[model samples]
Target: MSDWKVTHSPSAGRRPRALSPLREHLRDTFWFAPATAMVGVFLVWAVASEIDTRIVEALQDRGDYDAVEELLKVADDARTVVTTVSSAMMTFIGVVFSISLVAVQMASGQFSPRVVRIFVRSRITKATFAVFLATFLLTLLVLTAYDSDPDPRLVTSVPLVQSLVTLVMVALSLLLFVMYVNTTLRLMRVGHVIDRIVGEAFGAVALLPVGASAEGHALGPETDWIAHEGRAGVLRDVNIARLVRVARQHDVVLRLIPRTGDFVVPGTPVLAVHGGRVPPYRALRYSVSVGVERTFHQDLGFGLRQLSDIALRALSPAVNDPTTAVQALDRIVQFLAALAPRPLDASLHRDRRGAVRLVQPVPGWAALVDLGFAEIRGCAVGHPQVTRRLLAGLDDLALLVPEERREPLLRHRALLAQAVERGVPEASDRTFALRPDRQGIG
Candidate 1:
């Protein structure tokens, strides 16, 4: 198995959805926020200025310079208020706009802290300066427009309403821009990261040959069988990534297989290794399918403890010589028959040719038969029950080993296989009596 680093993500149909790319595009564009505000604010400010000027001119005709001046001063104050409010709003919006991008970057699970800092600074700092400058200029314009006038109020009510509208619009624009950009950025970043991991993992596991030969008469459960037949097997390759992803998506990590209880055996392709990526990012998300077919067949192998070993060790039919080392294997028929799990389950019989003679339905033995059906297709003419039991007493457990001591695991798996063959009654005549050859299977 390849070494893997874990990351979090949601997947769809065994792949992550195209969520990030879409979010990235939408946020950067701001979805028509700040631009619209700029236009609306400018229009309203111009209209308000014109209205105030006309009022001031009318008052000048009444010989009321003092009153005119007072009205102008009020007009100027109103403009200042609009400018200041808009400025603050813009600054707040800019800060949030950049802050949101960081959240998106973090979700991607990529990029260094320095790069993220740069990203945040450019967007927010620029936003703050632009908003403040625009607001100050607008305030100056309003203050200049006001003056004291005796005959009329300092500023017309219309100009006040106009300034308020302009300020609100500008403020709203900044807010909208930040919201749109930030939200989309977050979604897009996480989605892309998740998809990359899943894709890489699946592409790697499709290479194994159904344990032995996926080709020839066996056709290794040819694609069609996987499609139509329910997947019972001599062994199953559980897609662990899919399982974990499903648990996460539902927020319920169901422990279907206990970490310590699951079994893995020799000759059994226990795990499909996952590795390599399809592109610029080498992070791969692969599926390691554990053996489904082998599970029940192995249950059958369990009962053969003393009797089967005793049978294998007998040099002829009557003499026992070998020690207890050959525990990994059992005679194919004895192993299969013992799996009639239910107390009253029927027994499997072999004919003169050593072919399966009969499968009489025993009481409550459907599960055993189903398990047999799943695995029997992989059987050759002679050897019916070859298995790769985990070195952990036929259970899969990662015994912590130093990097240098990986050889012990391999040596043990090979020795277990050899030990089983020594006791086979028809080792010379059995079709698959010969063990499979792999460099480091143990």
Candidate 2:
């Protein structure tokens, strides 16, 4: 049997590693980067306008304005064109923002609220906002150069080139607005959302260190439990490399008590140090990060949780959308199929010398199976479509999963049958329910 286990100690003070408050704040606010870029755009336009003014003055001194009278007229009209474009872009941005917000709200209410983060973090959405804001700022800067009172000989050349550039930017922003709307609409779809969640969950799985083991490490008698010392929140991420380094230096094995998405309250055991002397409490504490909600950064379970939320919501009496639940189950099967062959029991981390330094708990095959299917199955009761699809999904997983990992699927299948037997009363209905069909019928 594996001696690996998580030890909890409530009295030992420890904190989880986290970014500085400012850095974390900035990360949550997606507008910061685009806002900074807009300022840069404004400054660049202002400087370029000054240079254009000097060039125009020199050209007039050389009597170039008379030689290119058409170009002179275009420059004279540049301010009006820029002002009009800037005002129009400002109005367009407001409309786009309003529409985007409504889409986000609808997605949140229809799907899972957690998906709103996906919309907010979308690069296309951010880029659209940045381009529109930059165009507005650029035009405003150029407008400042349009002097009402100017010497006729040096009529502050309207920065015609800059105004034309602003027009080009306006066109680009319009195209992006269309693309953004399309992307937002796609995000609202059940299939797209499930695919995205599955993709990201697999991506997180890929980040795990290859060939790491979770079963061999044995706890020493001198192990000291380190308790959490902050407000309650989900464990989001841990600086594993740093924890490994600290463990190596202290010649100890640090066992992280909670998986990434596990919630921890004050005085809960966060880590267990197995060595003669515990490493500095602060060092261990600073290596783990806790947040109010789970993020996809290193928390693979979070994606599963989000998918489950979507299915649960679909199963709700108010929604009564079994097809959506069935859709979520299909993706869950895919995620688990991909994960079944991986070394999920492996949590041991070693330093360069091959000595175990850190031992963190990860969800094993059984836990993931439960996370993926248990709640949704319980709620799936009389919904023949959802129950049939789930059994079908389990059957699909059983074919893909190794013999050792198939036990949980089989066990869950038995339980699902029992639940269906109880919730769905008619014998003929029960017989049809047991049939594995993706569409919930023979």
Candidate 3:
């Protein structure tokens, strides 16, 4: 039998390669989109101003009194419209985003705080803000272009195109406001949040390379260890290709000691150098990204962590909402089912000559299964809905996952049974909990 077999998964395909630190950090921020929109608005003003000037010159030269009169009338109307828009746009933007921020705060409180990143990274949120700011800036620029002298005949140019563009921008901003409200409302819903988390998790999974052996390729005994030399935080994503190139250059094998999502302190041993001189510590450190908290960029377990956190919060006695916990379990089972058949082995990055340059640790089937199910199972003690759903989830995974991979599911299944028996006093309730129902009580 082949040592490493990669079964096709629904997410099986070419995954995205590691993103540069700059791109990854920017992806998680809210400023870049609006900043870019402002710059683009400036460029648009420049072009529209030039076009308007040319159109006016042509009309004046052609001795078309009627056309010049119409253009001047449009410019007069546009000044009033642009003035109004510039005055109201900032207030509109402030109110909309303030409401959005409140909604996002409530969502973070309702679910997990980690979910705030979703809003920060939302394209709708970014695009809406960008368009709103763009409209405001564009209108202000158009207002400045209007002449101090009011006489239409004496004016060198009428900003006809700028006026039209500003009006169009106002209409677009109003349209996006409706879209932004709808998106923000959906973000508050538990089902939508859970599904989004799962979707993002799949995206992270798609970045991992496939067809690696289950038994990880062995790098010989390490000669030196590279300690982390930065502020303590979670190890996010590493530039695998860059590290591999560095290793290949120095004829060494470098093994990343901490997995993605693992926290590293300044002195934490982050890498192990084997079979050659250690590459520069700065070079190795620079190749990896450490951040304040976990992100979905390359950390598969972070998704599971978010789902579990929501479930645990739901199961808390303070919340007493088993239904929400069941919802969380629904997505958890979905993620695990999709993950069950895929390769969960250490990823080996190699050079062109087939030499292993870097070895990275990946969560195996058991670790992921546990990450998805463990804590919730512990907290699910007295909640029948959550217990039934947990049992059902494990049973489903047991059937779907291969026999060898079913051990963790079976172990959790037995643990669930014992917990149910102890937590449910009456025999009938115990039996009911033991019997699996995909929809919890249903």
- Each candidate's TM vs. the true structure? 0.26, 0.85, 0.92
Q: Report, for every candidate in turn, its global Cα lDDT versus the true structure.
A: 0.34, 0.76, 0.83
Q: Which residue pairs collide, candidate 3?
A: none
Runs with alpha carbons beyond 4 Å of true place in candidate 3? 1-21, 63-66, 151-154, 209-216, 352-354
**Candidate 1 structure quality by residue, lDDT tens digits, 118-219:** 233233433543444445445445544443343354444335545554565467456645655664454344233222222222232121111211111110
Positional deviation of 244 in candidate 3, in angstroms? 2.3
lDDT tens digits, residue span 42-76, model 2:
77787777776776777778877663355556766
Our tally of clashes for model 1 stands at 54
Each model's number of backbone clashes?
54, 5, 0
Sort all candidates by TM-score, best to worst.
3, 2, 1
lDDT of 3: 0.83
Query: Could you tell me which residue pairs clash in candidate 2?
Result: 15-285, 16-288, 17-286, 17-288, 214-346
lDDT ranking from best candidate downward: 3, 2, 1
